[model samples]
Target: MKIAIIGTGYVGIVSGTCFSEFGHEVVCIDKDAAKVAALCQGQIPIYEPGLADMVAKNMTGGRLHFTTELSEAVPEADAVFIAVGTPSSRRGDGYADLSYLYQAAKDLAPHLTGYTVVVDKSTVPVGTARQVARVISETNPTADFDMASNPEFLREGAAINDFMRPDRVVIGVENEKAATVLREIYNALYLIETPIVITGIETAELIKYAANAFLAVKISFINEMANICEAVGADAIALAKGIGLDGRIGKKFLHPGPGYGGSCFPKDTVALLRTVQEHGVSARIVEAAVEVNAAQKARMVKKIRDALGGSETGLTIGVLGLTFKPETDDMRESPALTILPALIEKGAKVVAHDPQGMREAAKLLPDSVIYVENPYEVCLGADAIILMTEWNQYRALDFKRVLATMNKPVFVDLRNVYEPNKMRAIGFEYHGNGRGHEKR
Candidate 1:
């Protein structure tokens, strides 16, 4: 199948490249000429675990292409996918700003030459497919195309494996014609007995939000549990393991951290709330999840402050990671953003290090925070050390060397990477989330 993906961002580029790997000719189109140029030179815009290598391989194999102009690929393709951004409307609001998706629909509408399936590959609202259909129909009344909704379920770090061998392939199609084309496009997966769920458009759209919201609820529930564990002298890890071994509640997003973030849960939960409100329905569980997530982040700030002996004023703190999670350089809504800024505002000087997030973090974090190349360098002259994001490097740090470099041996493990008893044996005052701490 000849595929044209109308956005070269994370979802678009990864989906397009993976499609090409399935022996389908795919062209990823983006409005940003600089990004397109970089991709053409085998330079990836974002850092995913194995995306660059896969993109480079597929491009070399002459199956994947990148371009800035939509006109160059849209009319020649059998399917066109809209994979643009739909960020939150504002900081506090959860409404999805669908301007980009609508623009993609409008831009590609005029170039629809024949029977083509215009698929919604973005994590859009329930009626977004209908809106895209309306926009395309209003723009080009004579064009014949079928609209399908195919939401992606790719985790950021392990997106490649998720795409190659997914749990299921969902396609919301109105007719057999559209469904057949989508199935043929996913022929490789279909051959491997991947369950292709064909449903109505709205059900497919709702599935993505439902899945994300449920996971968000689970994460918030555990974080809330962690708070309970902290207050009651219990351990979150043991608690999680005890319940996660159950076949029903399988352990996936059970690790309680600085709340859920990074391009999916936060936005999707908010969007789901907005959608529920629009329909005049109650989403109390999701609303509580959102509230718990915010409270968790604030609680982390309080934890750090208390660990500093009541105040963060005039202290040098070492921060381990900046990205939301490990193996990815995405800092959007990272816990460090909230914690560091609050501490900096309270007059604490911070030195931070991450394997890949420093460049992006520097743009968002305040100037009071110093970024260094080496993780241990962040520990130099530090009063306390914070393991913010659990990157691989921070997990196996030499505690003796770390203690030698720091001014005061205050180890605050927000990710709970190291055990409290072990840190005590090593002679450092360690603080862990949800672990019974002797000190503040």
Candidate 2:
């Protein structure tokens, strides 16, 4: 099948590369000439694991291509996927801005030569496919194209494996022909008997929002439990483990942390609530989860200050990890983005290190915060150390070396990377979220 994927962000690049790997002639189109040039030159603009290699191999085999001209690419393709970003509107409302998706449909409309399936691969609001269809038909009334919603469930860090071995595939199409095209496109997964849910466009759109909202709920629930455990004399980790063993509870996203901060959850959860509200419905749980996530990020600031004997003013704090999570450089809505600024405002000098996030983090973070290459160097002459994001590089740090250079031996583990007993035995003041400690 000849497929053209518009936009080369995380979703577009990964989807196009993986589709090409499935033996389809896939061309990813982006308006940015520099990004298209970079892809043609084998310089991938984003950092996703195994993506560059797969794109390279597919290009070498003549299965994949990149282009800036959509008019030329769309005419020759059987399917055109709009994988552009649908970021949250800045109007203080939770609506997902669909301008990019609409623009892609308009651009692809005039070039539709035959029966082509225009698929929405971006995480869009409900009824967006219908809107895209309306836009296409309005632009070119003679264009013969069917609109489909095929939401992606790929995680950022583990996108390739997720694309190849998805939990399931959800495709929404209006007719058998469109369904058949989608089925053929995902035939690789069908061979393994992967469950595919064929639904209406609205359901397909809601599934992505619902799934992300639920995960955000789970994260907020655990963080609230961690706060409760701190008040009581119990460990949140053990509590999570005890409940997680139940088949219904299944232990993912149960670990407590600063909060859930990434491209999807923050925007999707809020956008979902916005959609729900538009339909005159109340999503109290999702609403509470969003509030909790915000409070959790703020709580982490107090956690660090409290660890430093009551205030962050006039203190030097060492931070390990800045990305929202390890294995990716994405800093969008990272807890560090929220927490670090507050600390800097309170006059704390922060030096942080991440294996991959520094370049992106430097732009988002306050200039008062210092960035260093070496993780250990972040701890040099610090009053306290914070284990912010749990990168593998920070997991097995030589604490002996860490404590030697710090002005004070205070260690605050925001991600719970270390146990309280171990840090206490090592002759350092240690604070872990929900690990249970007596008042300072």
Candidate 3:
């Protein structure tokens, strides 16, 4: 299979590299010459676990290539994947911005030589595949291509494994030819008997949005439960465990935290809501989840302020993590973005550290935050320590050193990574979410 992927963002780069690893010839195209050059030299722009090594191996094996020109790879390709970004609209309408995606289709129209399958690998709204097809046909009426929808479900920090061992593959096509090409591209997964759901193009597009919205709802539901546990003098961890043990409600997104924040959940949930409302349907449950998620982050600010003796004014607070979750450096919609700024506005001096997100975090966070080189350095002379993201290093911190270094030994565990009883025994004032009954 010869695959040409447009856009070198997270989805495009990962999908293209993984396709090459499957023994398919792949060329990832980006308009940015510098990014293409960096990729060609084995210099990856993003920090995904094991991605750089895989890319290097495939490139060295003559299976993967990167270029800024579409003509370099599009003409002879069996399938051209549009994996560009579909970020939330800047107009505040909660719709996905599809200008980049549509432009990619127009650009690839003239280069289509034979019966090529044009696959939409980006998470997009319903009917986007049809719109892309219309755009390509309008641009080049003589082009021979079929539109297909193959949305990606890659979780950041675990994208490689998710691509290779996906729970299932959902492909949308109008005819057998397009379906056959996509299936052949994923023949490796087919050989392993990976379940593939072939559906209409619209259903495939809606599936991605529905799946993300449901996960967001689950996360918001757990956070709401955590709040109830705090109010009723119960433990959310035990509560989650009790309910999760039920065969019907397995334990996946039930872990309580500040809120759900990442590229997918926040953006996709709003997009889903927008799409539903646009169709004259109501999505009240998803709407409430969005409201609750916003409130959860605000509540975390209050939780920290309460732990700081009713105020954050003039206090030095240490944050252990900045990225939304660990193992990736994506700060888009991270709770730290909201929580830290609110605390800073209340006159708190903030210090933060993340294993891989400091460079990116510095760009999104307020300039007042002091970025530290070491994890423990964030605790130096701080009034309190807030365990924001559960990075591996923060899990087993030298509490003795932290207790000694802090001006006030106030520990606020937002992620509930530590036991409330054990932290209290460690001679520091501890505050954990949904563990009101654990206070001694």
Best by TM-score: 3
Q: What are the runs in model 1 whose C-alpha is more than 4 Å off?
A: 437-440
Put down candidate 2 lDDT per residue, 30-65, tens digits, no spaces: 999999999999998878889989999999999999
User: Model 2: residues >4 Å from true position, as ranges?
Assistant: 437-440
Off by over 4 Å in 3: none
Give the Cα lDDT of each candidate. Answer: 0.91, 0.91, 0.94
Least accurate stretch of 10 residues (summed lDDT) in model 3?
Answer: 431-440
List clash counts for every candidate, in order. Answer: 0, 0, 0
Clash number for candidate 3:
0
The Cα error of candidate 2 at residue 352, in Å, is: 0.8
Q: Across residues 125-192, which tens digit of lDDT does each residue of candidate 1 receive?
A: 89999999999999999999999999999888889999999999889999999999999999999899
**RMSD (CA, Å), each prediction:** 1.3, 1.1, 0.8
Q: What alpha-carbon RMSD in Å does predicted model 1 have with respect to the real structure?
A: 1.3
CA displacement after TM-score superposition, residue 36 of candidate 2 (Å): 0.5
Worst lDDT run of 10 residues, candidate 1, spans 431-440
By how many angstroms RMSD does model 3 differ from the true structure?
A: 0.8
lDDT of 3 at 237: 95
Give the clashing pairs for model 1.
Answer: none
